[model samples]
Target: MSDEDGAGAGEQLSDDQKQEIAVWFLSNAPAGEIHYVAKDVRALLRDEAVYEAAAAEAYPEYNKAHLVSLELPDRSGDIIITTYGELDKNNYLDPRTAQVATVDHVKQTCTKLRPAADEELPSAYIEEFRNAIDMELSKYVGEAYPKGVCAVYCTSGKDIEEPGADFGLAVVISAARRSPQNFCNGSWRSVWTLEFSYAFQLVEIKGKIQVDAHYFEEGNVQLDTDIDRKDSTLLQTPEDTAVSVTNIIRHQETEYFSSLEESYLNLSDATFKDLRRKLPVTRTLFPWHNTVAFTLTRDLANELGIGK
Candidate 1:
């Protein structure tokens, strides 16, 4: 097909054709040339149909795919070549094919499903709880870290079952921070990372809430020093300096983590209602009857085609 016609019609090329285009582009395209690739290698540099077909063959999982150059956040003149896939209705990539879960994925997977009256908490609830924990721990973007490298994640689950409790909630909260310091005449760069993981099950007993909590925390410090010994001070070698600095920072970070854990524990035990009130986006609570009524009204409107 003519390039213009193919472009206008949005033609779906066959796999073999796409493969041919991809092979041709790879043979002619130079490495690390992001501008050429970003400007639609298929349409700008070669036949549109040929270029698109090749992309499809290479990235079969994406319905529509294209090459893009993404610059590193460090502004180090480094660029990564990756495919930008077509977004779904929710403006998110499909989680089944994506390596990382988006915020929408967390919301959908972690939000507790309403349970049937008097039924045991669903097995799915445990999976959701586990997923939420994993999601929170895995995040590496937040204000606390350099350039938003680490994130704080929190998720909640309701209707947890416990003896002598009317209702229960499962809460997971995690945070991480990295602080970097330059010392010894700018010869050494030290990065200190502190991480906190806290999980709690809050159950209401005798009209008062109680919490059972567990936590795991750690702090890491690493030093990147100049390879040359010229910058070393006469009093202490780089190795000795590193050891002393690491020890002091590690001790301080441990105390910091302990303090944070104690504060959160107190909040969970003494001010749980206040904590719970801050979690959800909306404070307004709707009755089950109101939801049922809204659903029925929507169904009736659809049947009558009133909006249409």
Candidate 2:
């Protein structure tokens, strides 16, 4: 038998095939980085009833899945948002036993350890989960297995001097990491091999869309963490999605202030509530980490010129 087969596979793979897979991982799901997070999130929004169990792992701050799943299937996957408290402070890599090895060698190793045929979770699982929820979101969306699952955790140690530049989910993740002294170290437990997929409506991306945000003034933006911190269960806590949203928007505004200075449209309080009701769903304008600065797609950006 060759050296390529995983737990259940055929003969060993060629060096070229191994390298191709490794390149694919770097391009698509580079470990610890967050790209296209819409996939793994639908189940959380689709099945709020499972909030209690998942919260302990998925969302420690809040529970009660809502509409966050809609935007999910759009951009989702298992993102290395952050690692556990046991951070690898030492930049030193473990001693290498062997000399230089081709990228294919590493790929072959990964293939044997874990099967490469990764696909989004099936709708059947989502349905299995939905059936378990108490609130029975059947009215809103009581279908079956979710398309995927995405977990985002922030690594504890890193050079965060730059506004938003890190190995994982970029700024969104680094910012999400709570202070180490705050207990739980701001990181959450999550499933490792999960990913998600979604197709959201009201999808608006103005190439020139930029927004600079101001604090709500009333301090409503200040997160109320007492409740979440006290709870040992994740589902019981309030998902940090609300605060997470506002923070992202603020960060974007601050980082890309020049570009997004006046590019945003404010939502009314009621509208904000409408958005909040969707919790974690991509439909909600989440107020992503810092600022809200996403330029329109080249295709959409041209529209402004037409009107101008």
The whole-model lDDT of each prediction reads 0.27, 0.22
lDDT of 1 by residue, 1-308 (tens): 57766544577766565556555554333222222443465555356655555544433221111112222223322111111212232122211112221112211121111222222222343334334432443232121222212111112233433222222222211121211221100011112221211222221111111111111123321211111110111112223433333344334433443443455445433443443333256665433332222232233223222223
Q: Cα deviation of 97 in candidate 2 (Å)? A: 37
- Top TM-score prediction, candidate number: 1
Error of 1 at 56 (Å): 3.1
lDDT at position 121, candidate 2:
17
RMSD of each: 26.8, 24.6
Local accuracy of candidate 2 as per-residue lDDT tens digits, 102-124:
11111111111111111211122
Where in model 2 is the C-alpha error above 4 Å? 1-13, 20-22, 29-80, 83-308
Distance from true location, Cα of 57 in model 2, Å: 23
Look at candidate 1 and give me any clashing residue pairs.
18-53, 140-149, 141-150, 142-150
Deviation (Å) of 197 in candidate 1: 20
